[model samples]
Target: VGNDTEPYKTQKYYGQSAFPSSAQTLTVLYNDHFKPEITTSFETGFEIRMFKNRLTADATVYESVTKNQIIDIPMDFSTGYSGAVLNGGKVRNRGIELTLGGKIIDGDNFKWNATTNWSRNWNKVMELPEGIDGQQIIGTGGTASIIAKVGGTTSAIYGFGFVRSPEGQIVYDNAGLPAYPEEIQYIGDASPKWKAGLTNSFSIGNFTMNVTIDGQYGGIIYSQTHHKLSEQGKLNSNNMGRETGFIIGEGVVQNADGSYSPNTKQVKTADWYTRYYRRANIESNSFDASFGKLREISLQYNLPKRWLKNTGLQSLQFSIFGRDLATVSDFPIYDPETAALNGDTILPGIEMGQMPSPATYGFNLSLTL
Candidate 1:
């Protein structure tokens, strides 16, 4: 069920009109409203085909729940007013999907084919409205801001880190670093827990080949392209270097019979006017949960039906392709799939030279008449 209504008008005058009959103004203000929403979903799946059928498989699982949720909420303009749409809230999403097909060989002059797919997603915000416990929903790519929040959990990573301590802990800054708190650091969970794809094909007699691969797992990427390439140093000009020294482990700060100190005035610094910029480079460079091969291998040819059998042109084909190409990851810098969940700030994932992810060797042609 769903419904909605919106209308607005305004005009007010109390000063300056020098006489239109001593000027005094007021115009009709109209506002009408209605909102309705309700949704529920559940899905199940199955599929299988074997051997003779050339083998095929499929699987699925899904869940969705949404209610009310018409958010616009956020207004206190010092009492100025202009912000309203409310409807409490609720959101939930659960998932699983898998697919596979095969035909390793069909033989008739030689043939082979393959396919694969995978997906998994989970999102939740359950409810919100009432003093707003923590609200934010993904942002970062250069200033749409946000960066995570909203019932959080999934290993959160919203942006601008280190500033905890309301019992949350993580505040430090006498010089030992880590102590940002002007605001920012939505913290954790950049999405992606699983996603995958694979493809393969081959042909003989006319010659053809194709291969593909893709992956994304566990999620969490806030490298802001190595924090804007380590703040302009250009991150060693893409060599991406950073390990500047001074993060002496865990909340750091010892000696009182705890040992570990190399005189920097007996050490204990960390607080350069709120622990260095961009919240300590987003809590010390974040990266993990990877598995990218993204794109790969392709080759093709097909043109020989007795050279298209007298121009009737039955078939013809050609191919070549490449992209982003390769990545395994220990992540020293660059490649984290160039990170972007979508918060569009001129294409986020700011790493400076900022335009990697290109490796195309393109060529394609197809004709059949």
Candidate 2:
């Protein structure tokens, strides 16, 4: 594969850096010392067929190591700059993919075929070239943020989390709301544990039918839209605790001596949700993205030869197809496959006011000469 690298980045200047007059002056935004990134990868795949070549299987395993990772490293403004683009990290990824296909039945007038595929990936940060702390900010869009750390997975969702007692009981603050740690905490991972798909096709006489179902399991996504709309009292979740006078959060409080006691704070109805449910910057906004979808379906039929004998048309076929017809997911907003930003981005699994995936259906006609 070809090398992937970003263009060289330079510090911003308030004025032109070059001299255009007798005197020239400018302010640099940050120090610019970035190097190109490099990735080394190796992959191997094999295929097998059995049962009189009616069943076939293929598998592949691959690993990749990326070095000299160019990232925008953060810095204190006291240094006269916000951050700098520098070559400062390493990441490794490994995965396996498997596919199986079978001709379940074959005859002069009837045929059926099936295919399935599955894949899984694991990633880790091998090193940080800048020698910075274990965790560093990599990307941010609205309340959602991504952080990279040594020995941690990539694209990890970083946000505020509720404090808990030693026995895993929620801790409430004096204000009766769930207390949050001062520092941002890693709350969720954006990578799925595995993905799979199945497709089947059948044909008899002049009619054919095909359908596919796919699914992704074991990942989380943050919905900035849900957070915002809930805060605005527009989401159904916002209705909770509103009709009631108060709602008590579940958990125990930790006293000064580190003793855990049952929480007796009666958080006001509005106060309870606004602090815990709203985007008060405390609640974990991440939700499971595991979902299954009816990806595609189609039906086709070939016209009988006698139907167009005088027209000199040897063959004609008509088909009706649909895409993204249905989906089942726990995610509250749009389809789990939707992304806030397209193309290559530092952070994934973030949805900020994303549109729903539209289902499409159409018909096609083909004529053979």
Candidate 3:
């Protein structure tokens, strides 16, 4: 369990002293408030051994919940303030982990061993006080966007879906395409269902080797950067550019004679630009919600014991590893592991030439007295 508190105070006033016969202070205000939160978590697991202790395994599952989450909600400055912090919502998470180790073969001259670990997590929004529903809980890292709701899971992205008519029917354009408005729709979320990992090691006749792999599956990532770049004509490779038609279609606000009409037409590229990009900051598009294998593969080897012994060294080893080694998507950009879902940072999963995570190849030595 955990708890937190914040305090704030405010004062607002208008003043005029001596300003070249002009007025100065329109509005002066100082404000502050206090907010507190608490969190609790629990986990349970087990360990077991078999085959005369040659094989060992362990598994664990955990659940965590937090309440009174404080956030700096943006304010309408027209009301005379920039923003304020409030205790608004709650979140919950649950996961399971499994690890195994086994001596495939053991003997004085040769031995073989293997080890693996796997895990899966589920997150949801447990509650939201009044006036705040269907919000998105974006992360601080890459471009991941999670959704928020009462009883909804964590790392979910919640926003407006395509607009529907008053009768709850999808509006279609003359082109027969579903007209998506430049405005966002609270249609779906971007959260993974699970993640997993594995590792193995072996030794035989004075030589040893090890390998490791890890991955995450069943999640979604929103690439705001890609959206912006694509709109600016930067990401020519992004085929989504061909999608200039609006889901809400188009409509004339006023007739040439100053009258309005319900006959809206298909939105054009100009409308798409003004509505989706210029105004909304280009974050509404570029969402990849697919299951994928994040990364896998690693290898290492130890120097022969006899060679190390003769060199007066206790041990010596070398290794090489690669990340984002493979992907199952047709995404033309780089790896999709660039996004995160938590706070209002930028979008994640948009792979710019930002420094790619390094894959290391090196060696090490250890000596014991």
Candidate 4:
């Protein structure tokens, strides 16, 4: 919870002419009657060791409740204010985490230790402010947003999507273009279903090496960067049709008598891609946020005490390390671990103008007296 006033931020995008007033625009509104948001949490955990303390396990379960959540109040664009900040309502989250470790090999000159951790979390909007109709927009990028809906997860993407039939088939119109839902709806959850990590350490002859890997299993993100890139034919995915100059849309088109027919109309490639990958086409622009990465690796050599005895140093060690060295993800423009920035607020799930994932490598030395 915070009682201090928040800072105002606006990123003026001059070159983009897609949206109405893309040059410099107003995004958020200030409110006078602001209340601090508060969250209360409870947790229970345990630690256990077995087999002469060579094997260990730790587990915890937690529940949290948040009230007066500071969120955005939806406003009409005609009013000149895209959204206003206010104290929304209640939310709940529950999760559990477990970690296990064991010594795979134990010896005087050689040893191996491994550990793994896994966690799962679920959240729900318990209540909403009056007149919100059970859902409230919390963050926005382009035309899509992160929203909190009653009985839904707090991190949900709200946007327009391609209209589909009962069997999960894309619906196309007479123009051979995909149709869309007139009403905005919840498209996907931004929160990951589960996350896991693994670490291993090896020691031999006064030398030690450690490796760590981590991953997020489930989630989705709406990326405006991907949309813009695809529309501009900068992506390999949208470049194929350019050579042929045109492409036919794949779906069933509605006929005059209301029957559906296979769409064979060859729409211009440029027009097809631009409309398909536009920012407002949230569902088409969103993708799975799942990713796996080699989080870190390090190697260290510790000088033997017998050799250090003659030197002034009591202990000495040298280490080489690398972090975020590698990653495997389906995200197009940057890392899947991206979020939307609206003013001073950081909202997860939507991506726009975020930086790429970074990697670091370095060497270090330690001396003990």
The lDDT of each candidate is 0.59, 0.79, 0.55, 0.83
lDDT of 2 by residue, 156-271 (tens): 88777778787877788877788877777777888899999999999999999999999999888888777767655677766766777787778877788889888888877766
Better of 2 and 3 by TM-score: 2
Q: Taking the tens digit of each residue's C-alpha lDDT, what string does model 4 give over 153-243?
A: 7688888888776656678766667776698877899889999999999999989999999999989989988888888888877766788
Q: Compared with the true structure, what per-residue lDDT tens digits does model 1 show for residues 34-54? A: 346566889999999987779
The count of backbone overlaps in candidate 1 is 21
What C-alpha RMSD separates each model from the true structure? 21.1, 3.8, 7.7, 6.1
Better lDDT candidate (1, 2): 2
Candidate 1 yields a Cα-based lDDT of: 0.59
| Top-down lDDT ranking | 4, 2, 1, 3
Model 3, span 93-117: residue lDDT tens: 8899888888887988777777777
For candidate 3, give the lDDT: 0.55
Off by over 4 Å in 4: 1-36, 71-88
Query: Clashes in model 2: which pairs?
Result: none
* Candidate 1 TM-score, true structure as reference: 0.35
The list of candidate 3 runs beyond 4 A from truth reads 3-36, 107-111, 129-147, 159-172, 175-178, 224-312, 318-324, 340-358
